[model samples]
Target: MKEERRRHKRLDLDVKIELEKLDEGGVTTVKYIKADVSDLSRSGMGFKSNYKLDVGTFYDTQIQIWTKEVIDAVIEIVRCEEKENNIYQYGACFVGMTETDTLKIDIYQLFNEE
Candidate 1:
């Protein structure tokens, strides 16, 4: 079995998310790609993107963690594996999150233990 390398536990969710790719210079792109937030944690989140995002690349994202609540963040692409049906499962790590945002995610994870 593959070892779980994640530092934080994740909550299975379907939150709405928008991701904007960053250029090599770490500049945010104008185009924002929409994808479902399949899973979440204080450290990072998971989703699938139609566009192939390179691992180690940076992206700016807006995630609707709760109804009527959205948080903006920067993330580094950690994994991008091509799954069946031509979809890519993308995993990223939060890069520039505040203490408040980290607490919010911890609270959410606590409230949503599977």
Candidate 2:
């Protein structure tokens, strides 16, 4: 079995999120794309998108949790793999997510455990 290197446990989730690429200077660019979140955790998330994004790049987005509260975060793409039919899977780490927002994700995970 593959060793799990993740710091936090991931929760399966299906949600659509819009992302705006950040420039080298950390400024948001006009380029926006939509991605489907496959799983989520306090530190990172996995998502799939038709639009290709570069690894090691940053993107800004707002994630709405199950409670209908939105968390604004910046994510750094750690890995990207192209699948068939132009789909790409991406792994990203939260760059500047606040502790309160992280706690919210944790709380949700606690209540929604399988």
TM-score of each model, paired residue for residue: 0.90, 0.95
Candidate 1, residues 1-99, lDDT tens digits: the string is 999988899888887677888887777689877777789888898998677888998888877765456667899999998988877899999998888
Cα-based lDDT at residue 101, candidate 2: 94
For residues 5-31, write the lDDT of model 2, one tens digit per residue: 899999988889999989987777988
* lDDT score, candidate 1, position 52: 81
**C-alpha lDDT score of every prediction, in listed order:** 0.82, 0.92
Segments in model 2 whose C-alpha atoms lie over 4 Å from true places:
none
Best model per TM-score: 2
What is the lDDT for 96 in model 2?
83
